[model samples]
Target: MARIRIDLPEHFAFSTTITLLLSHINYGNHLDNAQLLGVVSEARLRFLKSMGYSELDVEGVGIIVADAALQYRSEAFHGETMKVEMSATEFHDFGCDLVWRMSEAGSGREVARGKTGIVFFDYRSRSKVTVPAGFRGHFA
Candidate 1:
């Protein structure tokens, strides 16, 4: 199995926490792979919403995931509170890559780490757009 690793810059910050339930578990008794993604997605939305923006809020200069990869280091069982941390590692003209690190809330040991590449898009114009100045400034 791959090891969980993340080295975030000091300027950027992103994080959220969530609890697992029986529904989040798979037949094998650990957190399901699909549900893991959903948990991270929820945290991402909540984090963005806290900043007064959302997936829909940035419609004109919104972003969509162009690629994503997740590496599981350990199983997260039901009822465990998992803390997910996200941050931008690379920012470019058209998009950025966000890294996610998940760990057990009690021990602080990472359980999984992942990254997603998001590309900006203008839904109304239906074309790729450059990263907005406001959004880019946050990572810098």
Candidate 2:
């Protein structure tokens, strides 16, 4: 199998902290692999909210996760606070990639790095839509 390597940007536009809960732990006593996405989802929401947007409304268009990839660096335990840093990149006509890195808050021990591909969507029309100009302008 090929290892996934994510080259993070020099700087992140947004960051938030989340403490792992007991529910986030798996049988092996670390952060559950599946729950990692949940953590990222929370960070993504915070990133958008800081810009006055939501998964259901980004400059008049909703966003759907088209794909996701993760590269785990280390295990995380409950009660550990994670600092999640995120940035938007890889823009296309209708979508972009939201890349992020997670690390232990104080120790700076990396936990994971990943990207989520998001495509603009129109819920009323139930169709894909073009990326909003205002949204793109924010990144520019």
Candidate 3:
């Protein structure tokens, strides 16, 4: 598949500093792929909160990861500080794509870049839902 450039919203900005945890590393001693995703998940929550959104608010329209992609550039070892920068790229009728970048804190070495495609769903209806107006406007 062809790769699409992730264009972040003009005014969007959300970031959090994180230290590599022992539990985030694996036998090989760098940040594990799975653990990196967990870090992204944590940062996503924090970002939503900073934007005044809660899980309930998200759940109202139903957001779920439909697909994800990650590219690792450098190693992040234990005790090393890294920053996860996140922003909304674009919103579709039923979902949205989120763009993210991770890098070493002080060194500024890029660790990874990625995007997650989140789909909106209606739990009660058990079907895909349209993106809520409140959220769509926030990123628009």
**Each model's TM-score?**
0.88, 0.98, 0.87
Which sections of candidate 3 miss by over 4 Å? 1-12
- Judge candidate 1 at residue 56 and give its lDDT: 56
lDDT of 3 by residue, 18-116 (tens): 899999999999999999999888888888888777644673655678898888888889999988898876677788877888899898998988888
Judging by lDDT, tell me the better candidate of 1 and 3. 3
Once model 1 is optimally superposed onto the true structure by TM-score, how far is the C-alpha of residue 48 displaced, in angstroms?
Answer: 1.4
CA-lDDT, candidates in order: 0.80, 0.96, 0.81
Looking at model 1, report the run of 10 residues with the lowest lDDT sum. 3-12
TM-score of predicted structure 1: 0.88
Identify the leading candidate in terms of TM-score. Answer: 2
By lDDT rank, best first, the candidates go 2, 3, 1
Query: How many Å off is the CA of 11 in candidate 2?
Result: 0.7
Model 3, residue 65: C-alpha shift (Å):
0.6
Q: Where does candidate 1 clash, by residue pair?
A: none
The parts of candidate 1 lying over 4 Å away from their true place are: 1-12
How much is 35 displaced in model 1, in angstroms? 1.3
Q: Which portions of model 2 show Cα errors greater than 4 Å? A: none
